[model samples]
Target: MLGVLSAMLCCGAVSAQQHEVEMIPFGNMDQWIDRQIKESGIIGGATKNVYAIGPTATVTETKAYKNMGGSPWATSNVMARVAGITKTNTSVFPEKRGDGFCARMDTRMESVKVFGIVDITVLAAGSMFLGEVHEPIKGTKNPQKMLNSGIPFTKKPIAIQFDYKVKMSDREKRIRATGFSRITDVEGKDFPEVNLFLQKRWEDEKGNIYAKRVGTMVVRYYTTTDWHNNATYSIMYGDITGDPAYKAHMMRLQVEERYAVNSKGESVPIKEVAWGTEDDVPTHLLLQFTSSHGGAYIGSPGNSLWIDNVKLVY
Candidate 1:
């Protein structure tokens, strides 16, 4: 299923400075091991698999750690009941690194016989982010909710960088292109996605969402990289709605050519430099990490993503 993360932040302004930002609490994964053992099992609440998608599932999810010193990071205990066996500890962990730690997100593949007849393979991916996870609601088209609960950030950053390593268990490369969608199925190991959204947003009394784009980055890592930015990042403009050619796509990449990523890992579009101007105030930042490419669907098991040292460079 889709692992959505919600980020929320109050409106404010940050001074302009060339500083290394520590936006994510416990970014080093130092206390994650202890948190895992103590806060594991059932921290938030339990979920029932009424859809009968597979394995007659019931998931015990972790509660969102919202009040942990204004930090919004959270973990879910993704366990499933398959054939009456209670499965526990299926997602989110801190793996040991060289005297430090790295957060590892993984996916599990499950084979279940639906209706006691056809066998179906399902993929379940673990995710981590700076937001809240809303459980799925029955009788609705919504699979799950990972709404943007952002923080008031004002400083303009040159780039967001981190260290990452990927490992895949399956050898199936080359995913077929579904259809009209240009997103052709490609081969390789499993795919993991990292995205950040910095925007000037607000909600009225009626909760109507309105926002002005600031900056963003969408990344897919293949090889392990050490502190690199702009290689695959794009910053957004203040408003992209007026563009007649703007066609909405996945992740709301609706801006026409107002923004673009540098192929050589350097400057973004000149128009993007207009982000975070005096007019655009009370911005909110959202960043998320996941080990799967598909939306609300299981992926190949044994796909692992190790992330470390996420920081913002201003």
Candidate 2:
């Protein structure tokens, strides 16, 4: 992936006739970091592999992962330690694509059985984003706070391009499984989605983050689709509330506040106060690809999304 980025950046700019495309570091999904984690001996002592989008390396130590090699990508694959027992969950994988690889995200149920008696099941939806997942997760409380979303980015790209394929679940309604409660049916069908937000953000004296939405681009797949190469979605700048393309359910302000690391090294919530003007330059970019559009712990089990060759068009 880094090699591909280097080649694209070497051209300085693509073609003057066409849109200039800049390959994001590790966005090609060719390289990955593999972690081999050993669960607690009480739970059969199984070794699990968790992956991340970064420099290619195999990590043997069972430790929390931070983004490495200047990569600006993170995944839902993670390790958790709760009640003094260690476990792992992997919903994202690096799948072979031609001579390289692509990210395959699956929405499914993960199970953990303890002492051959207690069995627990949780719904996990695979996701990839431009931020970090704080680990090892201690508990299920406030899952949003456990993630540091977005990254410092100043450029204003016209659109985002990527190759993708989606497989919708066979069920008509989504399901919710929190591992602590019985699974219940959600109202509507789930969809695979891609969202990108550009924001001008700031922090107050109390360490609370606020932002005005500078740009937004969101696309959801309602049905299964074959491989779409170089699919591009234009970024709509400023307040799009009156735009004909706007859909309230998909373009509304984030319902749950996303977290970011503050200057004091504390995770603080980012509040989207309002919309920005068309000319506003952004201070940060929040980009994500997910197998499920619904919130955490909600999705159909068989849904899957595959992505490769992500880029920003200038």
| Top TM-score model | 2
lDDT of 1 at 104: 79
Compose the digit string of candidate 1's lDDT tens values, residues 224-311: 3353322223333344434332224423542322122123423222122233443565356766677765544445566778777676
Model 2, residue 85: what's the lDDT?
A: 92
TM-score of each: 0.57, 0.94
Q: Rate the local accuracy (lDDT) of all candidates.
A: 0.47, 0.89
Deviation in Å, model 2, residue 169 alpha carbon: 0.6
lDDT of 1: 0.47
Candidate 2 to truth, TM = 0.94
Candidate 2, residues 148-243: lDDT per residue as tens digits?
999999999988889999999999999999999898999899999999999999999888889999998888998899898888777888998997
Q: Which ten residues in a row have the lowest lDDT in candidate 2?
A: 8-17
For model 1, the stretches where C-alpha displacement exceeds 4 angstroms are: 1-23, 33-67, 76-89, 110-122, 134-141, 146-149, 169-190, 223-251, 254-279
Query: Candidate 1: lDDT of 81?
Result: 37
Candidate 2: residue pairs that collide: none
